[model samples]
Target: MLELLSYDFMQRSLLAAALVGALCSVIGVFVVLRGLAFVGAGTAHAAFAGVALAYLIGFPPLPLAILFGLATVWVTGVMEEQGRMKLDVSIGILYTATMALAILFIGLMKTYNAEVYGYLFGSVLSVTSEELHIILVLSVLVLGLIVLFSKELYFIAFDQEMAEASGVPARRMYYLLLTLIALTMVVSLKTVGAILVFAMVLIPASTAYQLTHSLRHMTAYAAVIGTTSAVGGVLLSYAWDVPTGPAIVLLATAVFFGSVLFSPKRLRRIVA
Candidate 1:
């Protein structure tokens, strides 16, 4: 296991996992709090469409995926605000449309591209140095934005009406939060893939949610859990010759179940 670091690809994969894990879990706190887990899933599938579109048009997939994800979330937010549809319904519509687009684009290709499979199921072991750099830069950007807007985000997450009453710019903050989630999804694409990325976003934060009521504590705990799962999964994948994304998600699920079984909050509620 120690000797695996000697390989450059292994080093990149570990770094990618750690960064993606931490960022996804941090954003996931808000996702879990707002009941927007479906949003994450929607954005990830939308990004898959973007990836397929990029492949079709001969462009870089990450940037295009980011655009696609942001567009999807923005549309969802707009529809919800306009009272045109419920958020979940809007998300479901976009999710299916984008997934269909991805399928169509892939089908149109003259030859099957194995790389697309990597995006679908993850290929962290094949992470390139450039991809690692992008992940690092985006992780820093996402974390910084979160810190800068911590109070507003907290207010909006817990009580949007109250936040708006308090002049917290709730609507703007809502869109901003969605945008951040989209960006995080894009950055996480390679490490966890489109299909499994929502697990990274949901499981860690959900686990943390079971353990704590404080948003700060929840975020911190989620980050730690996400990081641990990602690193541990990578190691297990290496040892077992399994797919890295599912390995990471399974570890996260295990942690969540563990938290559910022994959560102090749950125990306190029961005892009371």
Candidate 2:
């Protein structure tokens, strides 16, 4: 482990994993509370389309992912407003459609490259300093926004009707959260890929929820669990030469089950 840290790429991978894990878990609390798990999966698939587009056009993947993800966010919000599409249905269609398009684009590109598969499953060891900077900046921005709007978010999450009755901008907050989720999806793509991205965004928070009723406690615990899972997964994967993304998600799943098995909240509820 000490030898691993001595290498620049391993250090970068660890840093990226920590940042991505923290962001995913923090935001994932709201996602789980609001039942937006499907939306996270959809946004990840949309990000895959963005990456495919970027690869086909000879551009970087990150900006393209953000662009496509934000567009999907806006469109989904509009669909919700119009009462034209339920979230799960909309998300399902969007996810499959984008994934199909991404696959098609990859096939049409006429070149098979290892980087594509790396992006699909993750290649954190290949993360560059610039990518790290972007992840850091985005993580800070997302955390700050989440902090500033914690009250509103909590209200919106727990009681949308009450929040709106109390003059909270429910629609606005909904869109804001989706936009942030979109950004989260984009940044997380390089770490975990679209296929398993939602695991990072949902499992830790769900586990935390099992352990606590307070949003503050949930967020804190989720972040800790997520970071630990990511780091541990990376270390184990490095040692065993397994694929990183699924390994990380498997670690998160282990944590989720551990929390469920030992949750004081569950014990109290049972006793009550």
Candidate 3:
């Protein structure tokens, strides 16, 4: 393990995994509280579609991914807010459409693209120094914005209607949450891949929920769990010669089940 850390690429991979994991888990708190799990999955597919198109066109994938992810979430939010369609319905439609788009884009490519598959299944062990810097900058920006708007975000997450009643700009805050989620997904695409990134976002936060009811404490616990999972996953994957993304997610899943088994709420229920 110590020998692994001496390698520059391993250091970069660990740093990238930690940043991506922390960012995903923190944003995931609001996502879980707001009941937007489906949105996470949907935006991932949309972002992947953008990546596919970018590869086909010989363009950068990051901006295109951000564009697609943001578009999907905003459209879903608008539909739900306008009562035009239920949130799940809109997300369900977009989810399938985006995945189909990804497939179509891949089919259009004349040759097999191993690099594109990297984005699909994740290759955190291959993270470059440049990508590490990108991950760091975005992680800081997102985490900072989260701190700046923490109170309002929490308000909207738990009770948007009441927050709006109190003039908290709940609608705008809701959109901001969606935007954050999209950005988080896009930033994490390389490290965790499109298919498994949602697990990175959802699992740590969900596990934290099993341990605490207080929002602040839950967020703190989730960050720790997520970081641990990412770092630990990278280490284990290297040692075992396994996939990094699945390893991270599986570790988090184990923690989640452990939390559930010993949850205070569950114990209280049993006592009663």
Between candidates 2 and 3, the one scoring higher on TM-score is: 3
lDDT by residue for model 3 over 51-169, one digit each (tens)? 99999999998889999999999999999989999899999999999999999999999999988888899999888888888888889988999999999999999999999999899
Ranking by lDDT: 3, 1, 2
Candidate 3 deviation (Cα RMSD): 0.7
Instruction: Score candidate 1 by lDDT.
Output: 0.93
- How many angstroms is residue 133 displaced in model 2 relative to the true structure, after the best TM-score fit? 1.3
Clashing pairs in 1: none
Question: Could you give me the TM-score of model 2 versus the true structure?
Answer: 0.96
TM-score for all predictions?
0.98, 0.96, 0.99
Off by over 4 Å in 2: none
How accurate locally, in lDDT, is each candidate?
Answer: 0.93, 0.88, 0.93
Candidate 1 TM-score, C-alpha based: 0.98
Clashes of each: 0, 0, 0
Q: What TM-score would candidate 3 get against the native?
A: 0.99
- Those runs of model 3 whose alpha carbons end farther than 4 Å from true positions after fitting are none
